[model samples]
Target: MSGGFFRGTSADQDTRFSNKQAKLLKTQKFAPELEHLVDMTKVKMDVMRPWIANRVTELIGLEDEVLINFIYGLLDGKDVNGKEVQISLTGFMEKNTGKFMKELWTLLLSAQKNSSGVPQQFLDAKEEETRKKKEESDRIADEIRRTRDKESRELEQEKLKKMLASAIIWVHVLYLKTAVGRRCK
Candidate 1:
């Protein structure tokens, strides 16, 4: 009746057997498998490290050590749940190298498109020249307007002077005729 009919052993023996079973269980957990996985990952990383470093240096413009440090920092970063998980930089690189290269090319293409390759000083000089040309055009327009206004005023003054002189002559002639008529009478 005792626990599957193995009641031949005494309570002390059973206790010893239980203790040994517990020890075996504790030792047989996933530790060995986890260690093997870690070793395999390390070997893979060793194989890929140089290639990854070269790509990062050539495409991303980072030194090998700097890139390694950055990758390690990212792998050590915490999740949104505030839990830290281990990551493999080599595995990440293996999976994303093509994507990284595509992004790098896109960035270079955009930069080439946006940049005219002109020196900053030359650009500034060109802008200043344009401003000066505009100012010169404005000055010439203003001067023309002033000259036209002056000519118009002078023409108006000449017309008034001629009208005044004719009126004075007419008045003098009329006075002479009235004087002669009175003398005759």
Candidate 2:
């Protein structure tokens, strides 16, 4: 569909509205009646509900009541028809998992990059995880270093034992060769 009806404030490729919403929306400056305003700020979250809806359906299991609660939470407690959300609002996300994950990452990254009010708790948690991982890696490195001398000593002893055994075998062969030569003479 060329999407002749239901204009948007932005020059975005997509209209960012459902078919019903598009019909209700005013395409031109002159509107016969007052209609619902398109909150461009929420365009991201509004699109997210349907985008990931199908992939998450399996996660919800057999609970119908859970869908309502889930939808409510998904909409941030916005008063919306649960049936509309269930039927048409979900599954707006890209179906390919890898692409979907990357898209979601970009979406979140854009939000964080653009916003000044990024939560301090998120930054704190990220720093904590990095510190813990670095400590674990350092502990392992120290343990390996501590055992290096002991391991090297044992390895050197093993090499000496193999060399001694080889020398004994060569001596026995030489002795047998001389004995066989004397018997022939």
Candidate 3:
């Protein structure tokens, strides 16, 4: 049974994966559907190609569950129209979004299960994924802090400007009053 599974043909699996890829493309609001580009030559995968290649590379190297978690993190990290994309696999499942994450889960699990010789690069990718997650979290925290600090500074500056303006106006009024009195005397 195991041997039969192994010989089930990569072509067939590729076709199945392709179908899911098409569906994924249609669902993407802003991102490019990356899975569909697998059949293309390496030269064709240019900068214009979306992060799907990176995602798949990461997926194939890590644990199935970890890969899913990482993908969810990526989806969440994306600020589409300045709003975070929070549709994780669990969130999608809970909300009954569609077959999007379901297919993604299948792909990851299958990739892990079918591999006879897992590459050392996969281990490296796992480390990178962890590092990236930490970096992203730290970056977000820094951004929030920076925004708050900037707002605080701006508020202080505005208050100082108002006080200076008020002082100048008071001084001008006092000068005018003294000048009028002297003229009358």
Candidate 4:
């Protein structure tokens, strides 16, 4: 995921993490349908974290039933639903509205992997996620309101300009009529 707005690198293993990458991702704007980027070479769904996987594609197709006979990509030598496996996130992309949401989950999951601060990060992530969402939504709403107000003000000015022009034209026409009447008298 070493792409735009994503700050991961192959050399990240040696670098000490101060949660900068996670913070960047969290603060970044949501990229729509990022899962379907054509030129962006994506890490396979097989590499997806359990957090994304559990929501994106379940390893088990059984709704409430436990996969008592599970193995690597196999359940008793047969696929889930006894027909085909549905483990790929891309396979579910057609109806998936929350593609970027999965990316957020992935980034958060990576933040904790192999780190001793997993517990603290996890707790903070949950609380911070909701708080951040509220903040962002509020900001966006305010921006939209300001924009609409500005547009309405512009529109009112335009209407006033047109009315003023029309009134001036009418005034000139009436004055010309009275002047012509006086000359004829």
Q: lDDT of candidate 1 vs native?
A: 0.48
Put down candidate 1 lDDT per residue, 6-92, tens digits, no spaces: 647776677655664445434532212122111111122332344446666765555768666664344232221001111223343
- Write down the RMSD of all candidates, one decimal each: 21.4, 16.6, 19.0, 23.1
- What clash pairs does model 2 have? 50-89, 50-90, 50-91, 50-92, 51-92, 51-93
In terms of lDDT, model 3 sits at: 0.48
Which digits, one per residue and each the tens of the lDDT, describe model 4 over residues 1-185? 44577565655564564555455445544444333222111222233334443543443333322221121233222112211222222233334424534443344333334243233445577789999999999999999999999999999999999999999999999999999999999
Name the TM-score of candidate 1.
0.34
Q: Name the regions of candidate 4 deviating beyond 4 angstroms.
A: 1-121
lDDT of each: 0.48, 0.49, 0.48, 0.46
List model 3 lDDT by residue over 100-142, tens digit each: 4343333333333334322234445778999999999999999
- lDDT score, candidate 2: 0.49
Ranked by lDDT, top first:
2, 1, 3, 4
Cα error, candidate 1, residue 27 (Å): 61
Scored by lDDT, the top model is 2
Residues 38-148, candidate 2, lDDT per residue (tens digit)?
Answer: 222433554355434543454444334555345446445323322233333235322332343334334334433444323334456669999999999999999998799
Instruction: Identify the superior model by TM-score, candidate 1 or candidate 2.
Output: 1
Cα TM-score per model:
0.34, 0.28, 0.33, 0.37
